[model samples]
Target: MNENASSDVKAKRQILIGLSGGLSALADRMRSQHAIATKITTLAARAEAIAQRSWDLNKLNSQDLQRTMDGFVGEIKTFAKQAIDAAVRAGSEALLGKEVAEAIAAHSAEIARLTREIDSLPDAAAVRAILQPLSVTLNTLPARLKANTAMLKDVDAIGALATGLAERGDALAAGGTAGNRVAVELSRDLRQFAEEATTFSLKMASEAALAVKAISDMAQRTLGLSQGNPVSDQAPSATDRLMTLARTGPQAGQVWATSVSRTSRSSPVQGTPPGVKW
Candidate 1:
């Protein structure tokens, strides 16, 4: 080949390498995004399941509080019934027939009214009313406190899950920037490749051009082969290249690209390496 044609071919070879690298980088970026998407999808499904089964914690619906109220109301009602009977009996012993009978009737009516009120008002206020006079420490207070603590913990767990989901969503959004970066770089590479291809075509048309290359030339160039070697005579075979990639790159938290490296696929090992895993 003439000097000019040789130089042109070398430049084209370098450009093709650049084009391959750009496309590989793009594929790597997409793979990373795919892994992230998979993780996010898994996490989202878990979050949704948890949300669907989340416990409803209403203060009024507390089992511990309800038990306490029921016990308080029962005790108070018993005490009131006893008090009314005693008052009516004492008044009967102190008064004449008509007055004593009227006192007993009035006491009975008041007792019935109190019982009806207690039965009708099934709320926290009624509980408080009965509990105030009793002045007794509730048996379920400790259990109720524990339940409240558990409820707070549930809230915190839900909040944490929500924050995680939000962060994952943000990461997915950020991947858009990565996608755009891949597009820009790939576009630049493909555009350069096209321009170089056109230049090669025009050069062939106008002048004593680069020699016509065989189909085998493309296979050789794609693997970066030259003079019966790739990179050097000591280069690993394709399978060895894959094995080396599996061995070396995975150790350092490398992700995205798992294929053998385009350059430096393996260092030339001299001795027979022990049974290598494919």
Candidate 2:
């Protein structure tokens, strides 16, 4: 009985040792599995963080791209506005130029018409008629004065003779005969003076005619010059027209510069990126 009991105790001791060994092995396996699970969890967390960072980076990149696109769009709009304004300005200038040219042309036509009317006046013909007779009379005046002087000299000689006779008569007491001789000499002198006065009148008339002719010539010449029909051969040239256009047209540089400045100021600025400095 004692032997059987000792044997049973030994068997129980062996069985306990085997169970402890099995438990220790099972604990080691559990520890290894726990370590693997911890590693896996850490790796998963890291991957999630990396993915989040990537998303953030993508968002930032997209925002930056949007901002850049907005800037580009703004610039494009500015260019378009400039182009449109330039076109409008050009059109306006063209219209202004045309209006100015038309106005100039109208004024020129009016001037030409007035000139023609003035030239067509009957003043020249009337002036010619007035001058021609006056010129003839002036040409004959000197001859008439010479003839009149000769007649006056004759009258003076007759008067001297008559005076001498009268003195002789007075000495002889013949008063009636002396008075008759003096009367005849006075009458001759009056006739000569009258002829000379008539000659002078003719000369005056001729001078008046010459004056009329001169005035007519001057008027015609002035009209011709005003109409650009210079007595000289020189005519207005293409350069003159160009100068006129320049004086009337808008300045090129000023128009362009103004348009550019206006377009720049009126254009919108680009949108800024989120959390980024302009």
Candidate 3:
């Protein structure tokens, strides 16, 4: 019984340590994943800048080309969000418990918090200067290009348009490269996130197994000790071991209260009633 009690304490202590370590690991992974998300956001911003440049250049008259670039940028953002969501959800499912539900909720809330933080940033004067001009330029491009084409010769205008188209193509290609980077970073971080969560859960599970073994040993020892055992004057007797079991067993509080009642009833009291009420 003594050995079992010692083992149970050790097991409970190990379980606490394991849980603490696992939570620490999860916190670190969240930060790492957040860094990856930030990188993707930065790349997405660069891609948007490239697209904005392409739009400002007005080299391509085709709306379809512009739409394609816009679509690609949208896809990059969508894919980044989807990758994180899936990774978190997969990790939660792998753990398959209340903690799993809580983790998924935590990650979701974290993403939303990040989004709010981004939205709360003050608009930069420099970015506004560039983007406002680009918007005005795009808005007036058709008229400006048409007027210039009428003033210039057909051949000269065609040559100018071709140069503009080449520049726009280069900008679009740059945006595509940026989008690729976002995808790569997201994919790599997602795998790491899943692995970290899964590993932490497995370690926690192992600690839980130890806790179970200890409890089972404790129960067996409790029954065996109740039949009495040999002991010296210093060593724990059967009653001492039984008391220890009572402290850890179910209805511990009730048993403690009942013991206190019995002690009070047996002890000498100066002026206490025989049948005291709660």
Check candidate 2 and list the clashing pairs: 131-209, 134-205, 134-206, 135-206
Task: Provide the overall lDDT of each model, using Cα atoms, as 2-decimal numbers.
Answer: 0.28, 0.30, 0.32
Tell me how candidate 1 scores on lDDT: 0.28
Q: Rank the candidates by lDDT, best first.
A: 3, 2, 1
Question: How many angstroms is residue 10 displaced in model 2 relative to the true structure, after the best TM-score fit?
Answer: 2.1
- Please tell me which model should have the higher TM-score, number 2 or number 3: 3
The global Cα lDDT (0 to 1) of model 3 is 0.32
Better of 1 and 3 by TM-score: 3
User: Model 1 off-target regions past 4 Å?
Assistant: 1-5, 52-278
| Predicted model with the maximum TM-score | 3
Residue 253 error for model 1, in Å? 40
Kindly list the per-residue Cα lDDT of model 1 for residues 232-252, writing each as its tens digit. 223234454344334321233
Error of 1 at 264 (Å): 53
- Higher-lDDT candidate among 2 and 3? 3
Is candidate 1 or 2 superior in lDDT? 2
Name every residue pair that clashes in candidate 3: none
